[model samples]
Target: MEYRSEISEELEAWERKITRKSSMVSRSAKRIQNRINGVIPERLHSIVTNSIKTMVQGVLVGSTYTVHPPKKNRSLQVRDQQAKELIRKYKRIAATEGAGTGAGGILLGLADFPLLLSIKMKLLFDLASTYGYDAKKIEERVFILTIFQLAFSSDDTRRKSYRKISSWDESLSQIEVRKKYEEHDWKTFQLEYRDYIDLPKLLQMVPGVGAIVGAYVNYHFLDWLGENAINAYRTRMIKEENQTT
Candidate 1:
């Protein structure tokens, strides 16, 4: 009971943190991203959008990926511990992949886009399981992906995504998340994702420093995604407890 209270307080604090206004640094970074977007060609953008569209479906929905079965009926604290451990495990793998590809220069650096994305989705599946949610369900998969968007997006985008999942217990039943996933806005999703990481990923392709940049960038990316997933799931679990009590 005491642990639950502590976690509830933590969740409330996290909620406030995310809802806060965008910092000047974030605003300036978005402006820089806008300029970068302008410089990139539409043809390249189309290619990227199309490619990631297929990749997202395969990774998030396909049966190819499997999460090891987690014991059921665990307490929230136990689940939270498992989630953190999974994140640490995957973070190392992502960092290694990033370094290997980054050292290969432009071609390999390009490969890291899908590679890093797959690693994230994989982590989400494991996380869902730890939290006693089944990722095999289409709606659960969509929710998992939204957590990714929440982590990587701009301040405004993050807020919008956060609100959609804030009351997921009621909202999931109220809306057709499955259909929403089917008709997802890949172009916008990919655009926001690319813009967010454009500079560091761009620098990651530079011959001499590519490896170091890739390692650093990918490590932090997975870390960000993992943290958001934990908080999102924690919020949902807490909501369920409150309703039942």
Candidate 2:
């Protein structure tokens, strides 16, 4: 009970942070991203969009990408501790993948995109299981995508994504909940993610510094994603709990 109360307070504080107004630096970063998008050729954008679409589809449909069996009836504190351990485990895997590809030059660096994405999605599945959810459900997968976008998007997009999931039960109920997973805003989702990490990832392709950059970037970015996933899910879980009570 005491732990639940403490977690509830943490969620309250996290809500305030997510809802806060964007600062000047954030606005400027968005503008810069817009300009960069304009500068990049449409052909390249199409290629990236197609690549991400294919990669994501493969993971979503692949047989090997199994969800953790749901942890039935666990307390929130125990669940969260397990989730944190899973996140840490994946973070290390991502860092190692990044270093391996980074050391292999441009080709390997390119490979890291899909590889790291798969790792992140797998971590989300484990986290969902720990939180007593089944990742096999269509709505749950959509929620996972929402968490992914929340992790990778720009400030403005993050704010919008956060709102959609923050009231997840109500928001999810409004959706048609297709089993095919075709309704997501893939274009905007890919664009925002690409633009957000473009510069650092681009530098990661450089020969001499590639390994160091890849390891450092992947390590930190996984940590960022883990933080977002935890807080985002916790927000929904807390909201649902309050309603039930």
Candidate 3:
């Protein structure tokens, strides 16, 4: 019980961090990306965004059969510890892939976009299983995307995504969340995600800097993503546990 209290306190702190205003660095980066985006043609933007939107939707559909052994009885600490190990393994894999692709220049740097997205999606599915949630449901799969957006979108979008996450498992959220999921914006999901990563990933195409940028960005991004997933799942578990007791 004491441990749970500590976890809850930690979560409150993390929540504050996520909801805070964007830093100067983040704002600067967003501005730079906006300028870069402006010079780029609208057609090009549409193509890339549509491509990613389709790819992600495909991944969601493909993982529809994902089933876990249903460790619903598992303790949160045990589940989270096991999840951390998996996250470490995934982080290494992403870093290595990023380095290899980044070394290969523009072509491979472009390849990393789709490849990394797939890896990120797979990790989300693994995490849902780890947290004893089934990703097989359409609603849950959409929630996985919400987790992704929470980690990588603009400040406004992140706050919105966090609300959906915070609302998880609460009586008021179920029907509302279902309606929201039906109205989920795949285009915004792709655009915000792309804009967020474009700076480091674009640097990853440079001859001298590509490999290092790729390795560092992919490694840390996955780590950030892992923490976000853990906390999101923890919110639900903590709330449910409280109600039961």
Best candidate according to TM-score: 1
Model 1 lDDT per residue over 17-36, tens place: 77787789878988877887
Select the stronger candidate by TM-score from 2 and 3.
3
- Pairs of residues at least 3 apart in sequence or in different chains that clash in candidate 1: none
For all the candidates, what are their Cα RMSDs to the real structure? 2.0, 2.6, 2.5
**Model 2 agreement with the true structure over 25-108: per-residue lDDT tens digits:** 867877888888988888768867776777566545545468877888877778788878887888789888888898888778
List runs of model 1 lying over 4 Å from the truth: 67-70, 172-175
Instruction: Encode model 3's per-residue lDDT on 1-245: one tens digit a residue.
Output: 76687798779988998999999988998888778877987876776676677665664565433556546788899998999998999999999999999999988987898788777877888988888877776567777878888999999999988997887664335566556644667666667889988878889999988999999999999999999999999988787778898
CA lDDT, candidate 2, residue 166: 75
Shift in Å, residue 196, candidate 1: 1.5
Per-prediction TM-score to the true structure, in the order listed: 0.92, 0.87, 0.89
Off by over 4 Å in 2: 21-23, 41-43, 55-64, 172-175, 179-185
